[model samples]
Target: MNKIAIIAACFIAPILILVTMGIMYWVNHNTLVKLDVACDSQFAEIDNMLKRRADLLPNLVNTVKGYAKHEKEIFVAVAEARTKIGSAKTVKEKSLASSMMDKALGRLLVVVEKYPDLKANQNFIRLQDELTGTENRIAVARTRYNEAVKKYNTKIRSFIGRLVAGGMGLEKRDFFEIENPEDKEVPKVDFES
Candidate 1:
């Protein structure tokens, strides 16, 4: 209505709009970053679990070797898989290596089955328990990693998040999917007590 009132309205309205937009942008950007960080954190957990499993392999191999000295192929397969896992750099590389290690470990378990004493040995039993626990941990960690990746991927692909993520250079991430059908099989560890 009045000159001063009109001038104040013009200045304040734009400022308020600009401030609101700035806050919205900040929130969206931060959400994207936090989701990305969560995915990375879960990936680290998977890597650590894999490392723990790898550490137990050598001892288990030696213990079994004492009983099944002729089973050199299994030993070599496990050794090579462990080496591949250690040398892996990316998440995908590590995953493929893990699958290789799993197949090798599965074959080793079969060899142990053939030797009743090796299967019953106290040290072997303890190592088996530890390896089983570690495998469970790896499974859980991979689940969490995939969940985080799913959330992050959704955020980057959705409408509002897509706009923000694109401006921030964020991209969708792949889930920790098991590509090999053989790797999906449950390991045969059950035996009559």
Candidate 2:
């Protein structure tokens, strides 16, 4: 009501508002950066698991090759898929390459089905076990990476977060999704007779 009181209210109100806004912006920006780092870390875990699976493939291929020499096409396809996975630079590319591997390995497993002796081979058994373990690790890593991406994307797209993210130039991250609907089902790697 008084002149000095009104003047003080007007002056202090804007400073309080500005300080609150600055704090909110800082918090939002930090959240976005932290989510982004989490996405990167989880993706690295996926890459490591993929590399482990890739390493197991060759030995498995060799073991299968000793018995199924005539299945050259499947062997070649597996090799090419492995190469694509290694050379992939983006999330989509990696997903496609993984799908390719799944298809190729499925065919390879079908070939193995015809050869009873190969299934019983100790070397083949060991390689299959290692490959199975690697696949499980890959699945876990992929799930975590996707969860991180979901959080990051949600933050960047939310109303309040979008404003802060836009000012920070933050972008949505891609999920490690299955390229094909059929690929959603993991290929069974059972070697039991």
Candidate 3:
């Protein structure tokens, strides 16, 4: 009886330990996968929002062109940035192009600001409103994407997660970070400048 009890304890202890380790590894791996998926989906949402904004830009540009034909340089810049965004293949490229679009659109809006008549145009106002809403949605999606990336990166960098994540082929993902240097700079508040 003593011999049987000793043998059972040794076998059961190892089996229990093995089961616990297995479960922990699985849970961690699954969590990383979920986070990865969330990041991808959030990026896609941002892309969709950006696409919506891009799609609406031409009409806005045309409406403004009717009022301000002299602002051809700014219009061309906006068009070029939009084309860059359309042709971008990678996340980094797309981010850069989107930033360019923002700057170009900012210039366009500033130009548009000079003309109250254009602002009052029903179609221009509607397009501006839609672009603003789309920009807001893109911001939301970027925040969510960063959050997902944070969670995923934290997991892969943690103790137990580090142990199994490499074996499972999980890697750290990048946040939807701002790539444009100008975007990082604080605008001069001095109206005198």
The candidate scoring highest on TM-score is 3
Ranking by TM-score: 3, 2, 1
Order the candidate numbers by lDDT, best to worst: 1, 2, 3
Candidate 2: stretches off by over 4 Å:
184-193
Q: TM-score per candidate, in order?
A: 0.89, 0.90, 0.92
What are the per-residue Cα lDDT tens digits for candidate 2 across 2-107?
9999999999999999999999889989999999899999998988888787788899999999998888999999899999989997899988988898889889
Winner by lDDT: 1
The total number of steric clashes, by the backbone 3 Å criterion, in model 2 comes to: 0
Q: What local lDDT score does residue 17 receive in model 2, on the 0 to 100 scale? A: 100
Candidate 3 lDDT, 28-144, residue by residue in tens: 888877877887887788788778888898989999999999999999998998898888766688789889999999899999989999989999989988888989998998888
After the best TM-score superposition of candidate 2, give how far the Cα of residue 22 lies from its true spot, in angstroms: 0.6
**Clashes by residue pair, model 2:** none
Candidate 1 per-residue lDDT over residues 54-157, each given as its tens digit: 99999999999999999999999999999988888777888889999988998999899899988889999999999999999999999999999988998888
Q: How many pairs of residues collide in each model? A: 0, 0, 0
